[model samples]
Target: MTMQASEKTPRQKRGIAKTVAFVVILMTVFVAGFFYKILQPRVMNAVELRANGAIVFDNPRIIEAFELSDHRGEAFTLENFKGKWSLVFFGFTHCPDICPITLAKLAQVYPKLESDIAKQTQVIMVSVDPARDTQEKLAAYVPYFHQDFIGVSGDFLQTMQLTQNLNVAFRKVVQGDDYTVDHSGNIVVINPNGHYHAFIKPPFELARLLTVYQSMVQSF
Candidate 1:
């Protein structure tokens, strides 16, 4: 009877181990299903955010670390784009035509946006010609279009870090006494996560911009 009882004890222990393993597998499946159900809607929304004409990246490109000073002399970094949608343009304060025209068009769209939208969206002009576009000059030039507009300038290498990441091109076209930077005329959209989201090409229309921007923000 002692031998039989000892043999039964080992079988009972094996049965308990099997039950525990089964329970763990069941729990893992249940937890995975719960999370999948919770995340399905968000995954769908991201997919629906895709625009037709705008060049939005499928695999969002992460921006590198860069530090610059805003027109107000406040430090600006990759952190500034966090929790805020940003429209960035790389142009000089001394840009003859393209910069002013682009900024003017942007100004037209600024006030027309809903107060909530305006608060969440920021327009930044990053100077390609940092030598001449000082913080003082940026403060004067940026606000001329809109009071809320921001202008940033710092070391050329730091500025280039951002420009290159965004694929914005700019080169100095030196003439005898004056030089102008020939830059790409496209506005880059940065998502609240500080990732490169989209690029809007030139001849921007106010109504079209507002429509697309609102859609992008909502979907994002």
Candidate 2:
């Protein structure tokens, strides 16, 4: 017999092609799944959406004009807040519980920001009790919490220019030859454009704060 030919018919040829195609598709799917598993945690683990105390503004409110003094007695203004992100708190230096504790919490979270974000970020404590929170006093108080942190105070109207627009409230309470300030503990977030961006209400949780902060910055 002249070498009986072993040629696949149309049906046989089609069957072989189908088997090869199936194997190739399975391999492609397996490789894609493997990569997805490897990358999912790194890409998805971070807080990509706003959560915790974060309140994102659809339209960032334009900051009102004001002049204030920083800890070193330098001029601080809405213009100064431009070109960076600011986390501003309104409290007196003598606040018994909230002021120092909140600043300390901020200090903890401040360093955790990505370097790019950190470079564009600032922490400011605006003394509602400007009577006692002189620039010198602020100098001593603010840097004690974080060396880079700023303390600012001004005349009532100047301060009000900021606090009123931001909706931070305060009042003086006197008791037994001493006084304390009753003020809003919420922190205001100012965007790089020096606009009111959001509010963070206390009591703060650091991890949650960081997540929301990072998400906000990244999105912006």
Candidate 3:
């Protein structure tokens, strides 16, 4: 009977050890998957960093080319904007709130530009949702912000290519068979040579942006 009990003790120990090993493996897999799900978007964002600096335009992507048209029936290429500073914003005219707010603040900064500086600084608005923001609508909307502001758009293929090159992430969200574009809320500044100038991320401080604009204009 003592020998039988000894054999039973080994069997019980082996069963308990196997159970603990299985639980550990399950927990490790669960934790690894949880971490992956939490960090995926951040990893993708790291791959899309654009220019960042206080005075100069930080490193901007120069890898892609775009062909688009302006609101007033003029052909606007990346080439046409050469030799002037452009405050290029990406949004549709149909954007009811945020777009107008940004433009209004930009308007506040507009007249402050000195004449020589003003001529060099062109306010440009590019629509990420081109299917809806037509030339006429854009023409009307742009002037409400600043009389001289220019609005531009193109077909989906061309728009996507340009936005991607600029590192602007946008998605067309579909619901009940209709769709709306979910896009980033930031402005890109293109320099006189048609290279990137800088970017202004929002919650914008009007005083700071105006100051930055003045400095950049002086540099140009």
Considering summed lDDT, which 10 consecutive residues are worst modelled in model 3?
43-52
Global lDDT scores for all candidate models = 0.85, 0.85, 0.75
What number of clashing residue pairs does each candidate have, in the order they appear? 0, 0, 0
Q: Write the per-residue lDDT of candidate 3 for residues 108-162, one digit (tens) a residue.
A: 8888766677877888888988999889989899888888888999898998887
Clashing pairs in 1: none
For candidate 2, lDDT tens digit of each residue in 27-106?
99999999988853222122333346566778989878889999998999888889999999998888889999999999
RMSD from true fold, candidate 2: 6.3
Model 1 misplaced stretches (Cα beyond 4 Å):
1-53
Give a tens-digit lDDT track for model 1, residues 79-111. 998899999988988888999999999999888
Compare candidates 2 and 3 on TM-score and give the better one.
2
Lowest summed lDDT across 10 adjacent residues in model 1 is found at 40-49
| Each model's Cα RMSD | 12.3, 6.3, 19.0
TM-score of each: 0.75, 0.78, 0.70
